[model samples]
Target chain A: MAKQERAIRTRRAILEAAGAVFDEHGYMSTTIAMVLERAEVTKGALYFHFASKEALARAVLDEQVPFGAVPPQPCKLQEIVDMTFVVGQRLLYNSLLRGSVRLAVDQETPSGIDHGAPFRQWAQALTRLLELARDRGELLPTVKPSETVELLVGSFTGIQLMSRALTDRADLADRLAVMWAHILPSIAVPGLLPGLDARADRGARVLASLEERAAS
Target chain B: MAKQERAIRTRRAILEAAGAVFDEHGYMSTTIAMVLERAEVTKGALYFHFASKEALARAVLDEQVPFGAVPPQPCKLQEIVDMTFVVGQRLLYNSLLRGSVRLAVDQETPSGIDHGAPFRQWAQALTRLLELARDRGELLPTVKPSETVELLVGSFTGIQLMSRALTDRADLADRLAVMWAHILPSIAVPGLLPGLDARADRGARVLASLEERAAS
Candidate 1:
């Protein structure tokens, strides 16, 4: 058990190190040596966890798939809004998520890695949520789940990218709030408009509640 | 006069070749030699036109700034929509714009190059247009031009990027139309909604008319 725990820790260290390097230098410029140097792990140990730089990037990409921070809400539309807001907050401080975004968008990444997988997964997850919202009569009759999912995903990506470029992602949550404000009125049922809270500070509130629940 | 014309032609050829190479290989990996080979120009001639690879990227970035295709509309909001649609059409075939976008977003770009200039210019231009819309009483009283410009620029970027990733940008105009459909209601005054055309075919129509005017 002790040996197994040590191995797990080493693997995590390597992943974190690789994510930092990939975040700073991007996929094409990141090297195995940099990860090893940053991780303070032996080459053998690093190789044991990830075979190549592509594997490291795949791991970072995978980390973005299971975004488990968004707690459930009574309002499905609000839940979707919460999910994006929490993600924007996470992106502000989370190295792995930041690196995953970089890898996903970087045009120089080699074709062998499936960079599109994360985006497709995000779309699927959001589509499923929208379907649930529709079933609950939360969405307007004119709203199509698939189309809304595409817009949400694409617009979220652009908001984050622009925020990163202009403010180093300091205002990602605010930008996402603006995005949802502009989009929700068109997609949500008119009745839901008065109840939805798409404020820039919503993520911080949700995150605080999540941490509180975890502590309890 | 003949020599000056030849110089201008050589400069244009070099810009085109560099744009193509940058679009394919991105900024960090692209080499001056590849651009020279593609342009079929001597090293001296290429240097005479562009001092460095960064200079070439800046030139491509500069090409994206002069977006003058949208004809005047009584409604300034519709004119803003038309500008994006025309740009979508241009992006469909314009290597310079495509390359400029890649360079502007790529994380590996060196610090010496001003990657954010194009985006800032775009935001400034859009802000000016939105101001016009506000002045003309086409925008809702609640809408702020600066914030709206940021959202428009960010969302348009996301829509274009998502189209590129998913469909190789084949459906960019369609996506832009969808974007406007969702956004216009939030920002434009209710009266203007009936007259605005946010159809996917608008780009094709705008492009056709531009070509016709140019030929005449």
Candidate 2:
């Protein structure tokens, strides 16, 4: 148990160090030497756990990104979309994923493949939520769930890139929420958007209730 | 007259050549020397035409992308929106402005004020079009024009980035047109979307007429 705990600590340290390096300088700019220096680990230790830089980046995408496993909730489609918006805000609210994304764009990679592969996972999460929305009759009958999923994810990514490049503004979350609000109304079944408005109202009420409790 | 013609020709040569170099090797990777070589122009001639690299780039934005200019026809707001859609399609359809936009994102000049200046121009162009649409009463009264403009342009840029990075496919223009068909109705006034649809049908008819004329 002690050995396992020590292993976990070292692994986390390596991930944190890698995150800092990847955020500061892009994937291409980052060197193994720098990762070793940052993590305070020997080169042998890095190699022991990961084979190459690309593999390490894959690990970073898999383990370090907070979207590893879906949490247990009521599993409502809107809830999933709301959760995605929250996570997107957390990750792209700053330069956390900028370097990696920029690197991915600049490199000549094969189509539909990612070395880091965070985007694929993001798309999968969106697809899952969209499927649920379809099942619930939340989406318009004419709308293709897959295309809608792509549009939502694509729009969010686009907004994040612009916000990052231009103002370094963290308001992308709020902007995305507003965008989704409008978009949901456009794509949802005729009466579902009213339900969303009620949901928002309830959310506001919950916040008020929490504050009241805290005050008491 | 001859002197003016020569000047125009020289300017076009420089713009075309600059675009090529910018596309082949990223904006940061290319230099004045490389541009001159690609254009086959003497340093004196290049400098005489464009005071600096940034000046030349600004000129490209002004000349190559005439997105802000008034449309050739004076029609309904929906027609104008459709016109803007076509403009986006033409601009990004063939990688013509792909390098320019990528440069816009990648280049961080020492002058902080000039940063994101290119993207600002893009947003301004869209804002102008949206304003025109609003003046014509084509857009829903509640729709925020600035935010909608930002969303549209931002989403287009994102699609371009994805298409360029992944598939090397330039068919994003068609996809964008399809997306607009679905999304335009959402923000448009109840009566206005049908006008857009009518104009699109008219566009098809016009194209068919042109083809018939050609065949005759």
Candidate 3:
């Protein structure tokens, strides 16, 4: 059991180190040697976990799409909004997610890496939630679920990219708040629009909730 | 005059070849030799115009922001919509524009090249037009020009990226049509919303008009 726990910890460390390198240098410029030096793992251990740099990047890319920690909101639209904020906040500190975004957005990988998976996954997640919101009458009557979700996903992607470029995402939550404010007028039902929590630190509350849940 | 024209033609050919290569291989993977071979120019001739691959890419990046070919419309919002479609059409066939977009969005640059310029230029252009839109009383009272323009530019950037990834951007105009449909109702007064020409072939007409004007 001790050995198994050690192996898991090593894997986590490697991923963290790889994520930092990949996020910083992007895919082609990053080397396994850098990851190893940062991770402080033996070459054999690194090889045991990942076959190639491509494989390692693909693994990091996969690690980012899961935002399981944000507690569910009563409104499906709020859940979607919370997910973007938590993600925006997380991108400020989470190397894994940051690397995943770099890979997803700007990195030109070899043909083997699936760049579209994250986009499709985000679309699917948002589409499912949008449909739920639609059914609950939380959406404006004219809000087409698929179209609205695409705008949200695409806008959020570019907003974060611009925020990252301009301010290192120090203003990501504020930018997201502005984004929700502009979009919600066209999306959420009139009553729900006033109640939507899209403040700058909403992500902090969500993360605190996650910590509380874990502690309990 | 003959010597000057020949030099101009050589520069155009080199830029085109470089743009195609950079768009396909991205910045880091692109080599000077590849550009020389594709441009069919001697290495000395290539270097005479562009000092390095980075210089060549920066030139391609600069070439993309010119939407001057798009004729202006009386309605500032219509002008913005028309410009996006024309750009969408141009991107399908223009290597320089495509390379510009690739450089602007992806690729690991050596920090000498400015990736944020295009985003800033786009934001500024759209902001100017949106304010004009407001002056004409064409916009909804709630539309905040800067916020709305940011959402538009960012959404357009990500929408084009997603379209390129999913369908090689064959459906870019259609995707953009849907985008304007989702956004205009929120931005434009009700009367202007129905008259917005966001069809896929709108770009073709704009191009055809440019051709006619040039011929005349």
Best-matching candidate per TM-score: 1
Q: Evaluated with lDDT, which candidate comes out highest?
A: 1
DockQ of 3: 0.54
User: What digit string (tens of lDDT, one per residue) describes model 2 on residues B44-154?
Assistant: 989989998877666554543453233344544554455445544445443335556655544232233253666677777667767887787777877787788777766
Cα lDDT of model 3 by residue, A68-118, tens digit: 347777899899889988898898898888888888887386656887677
lDDT tens per residue, model 1, A1-216: 699999999998998888788889999879899989999999999999988888898898887756535889999999999999888888888787888888888778777888777778889888999999999999888888988888888888888888888888888888888888889989999999999989999989999999999999
TM-score of chain B alone in model 2 = 0.75
Clashes of each: 0, 0, 0
The iRMS of the candidates, in order, is 1.0, 3.0, 1.9
Superior by TM-score: candidate 2 or candidate 3: 3
Tens-digit lDDT track of model 1 for B128-192: 88998899899888888888888888888888887877778898988888888889999998988
**Clash pairs (backbone) in predicted model 3:** none
Rank ordering of all candidates by DockQ, starting from the highest: 1, 3, 2
Q: Which structure is stronger by lDDT: 1 or 2?
A: 1
Supply DockQ values for each candidate.
Answer: 0.75, 0.36, 0.54
> What interface-residue Cα RMSD does candidate 1 give after superposition?
1.0
Measured over all alpha carbons after superposition, the RMSD of each candidate to the real structure, in angstroms, is 1.9, 5.1, 2.3
Question: Lowest lDDT 10-mer window, candidate 3 chain B?
Answer: B61-70
Per-residue lDDT tens digits for candidate 3, residues B1-216, read: 699999999999999999899889899889999999999999999999999888998888777668535787898889988988898899889987888888887737655788777777887888988899999999989888988777777777788887776677887888787777777777889999778898878888899999999999
The 10-residue segment with the lowest total lDDT in model 2 chain A: A197-206
